[model samples]
Target: MEKRKEILNELEELSPILFKIKAEGTDKNIVVPNGYFDSVENQFLDRRMQVENEIDIDIPTDYFDNIESAVFAKIKEREIEEESKTPKRKIINISRGRERVRLSFLPLLTKIAIAATLFFFFIKGTDYFKSNQSIEEIDYLASISKTEALNYIAANTHEFETEQLVGIEFTEEIKNVEEITSEELNSYLYENINELNEEDFSEIF
Candidate 1:
């Protein structure tokens, strides 16, 4: 394009001694060719030098590509450096006091449980012994004579083959017999034959 070439030509004309000066200097101190264009070139170079001298740094290539990204990277680097200088936070176990107290009481609690269990069993055994002591023991046929006692036991013997009534023993203490008449025996057997039970046969003789 003609417009692009014109701009390039103008840029070339604007700078003739770009690498000639590395230090601060005015355009009047530099040489220029004799022409109307030389005056404009001198003014342009003066302005260029003034701007360059005011700058504190040489800008990086990437700064022109993405200015916001470059600034954000600089801010993040500063923050990382500040964090590295700060001390780390320490974590403390909150339950340590309760744990120590629990450990101290554990043995005492176990011993208490064991003692309570033993005391409950001992109380139950004593109650069982007291109850058994109150029960009356049955005496061996103390209300009947030797002949009558033998006959009564024989008659009341169980009829089941697995069950049998063995012998009886009289104690050292003597007992008085409550005698029944012959008429009473006859009336009892005649009237109660159908209603007779094994318990009744035990007293029939």
Candidate 2:
């Protein structure tokens, strides 16, 4: 208790406003000015009365009760006026025979165009197939050994036309005239004689 009293005395010496406790049995030295509390109490009371008066304000009795119905009635009246002022559409019947006749040739022309396109593609496709087949045949023949190819051609000479062999040259080893029989030679010459020109005849002779 003595320690606390000493600390308080030190604080009071340093700052009187910070340590305001009075000594035991001694009245507080700080005093309020005359009428300060009276003026503050009167201001609080005036503000309280003003707030109470604001809270106790009044409004018309039926205003809220009819607000929703009045708003809805006004909206419905506006909708009705808009509907009355809007223009209505009327459908008129008319003949379409002339229009139909004018466009009648379109379908026929379209069909003809489609057919022509198909025909053109068909012709091109056929030619492509024929050319591809011929190329495959030539490749197959070229892949065979020359000896086997010559033997095969010699064996099947009657089956091939003269025009088919026009550009080909026979090697001397494969073209020995003595190896061909007289009957085969005669038959080949007789069959291709009509197609032979003077140059071919001169070479043969």
Considering every candidate listed, which one attains the maximal TM-score?
Answer: 2
- Residue 77, model 2: lDDT of 51
Error of 1 at 132 (Å): 93
Task: Kindly list the per-residue Cα lDDT of model 2 for residues 118-150, writing each as its tens digit.
Answer: 333344543433333333222323334334443
Worst 10 residues of 1 by lDDT: 169-178
How much lDDT does each candidate structure score? 0.37, 0.43
The TM-score measured for candidate 1 stands at 0.16
Candidate 2 residue pairs in clash (backbone atoms < 3 Å) = none
TM-score of model 2 relative to the true fold?
0.19
lDDT string, candidate 1, 1-205, tens digits: 5797676566557764642342234576667678868589889999999998898466655645663343334334534553466344322221332231111222222222222323333445334333433222112223323343333333333431111111121111111101222343345446646655554444332
Give the per-residue Cα lDDT of candidate 1 at 112: 24
TM, every model: 0.16, 0.19
- Give the poorly placed runs of model 2, Cα more than 4 Å off: 1-141, 173-205
Error of 1 at 147 (Å): 99
Error of model 2, residue 41, in angstroms: 99
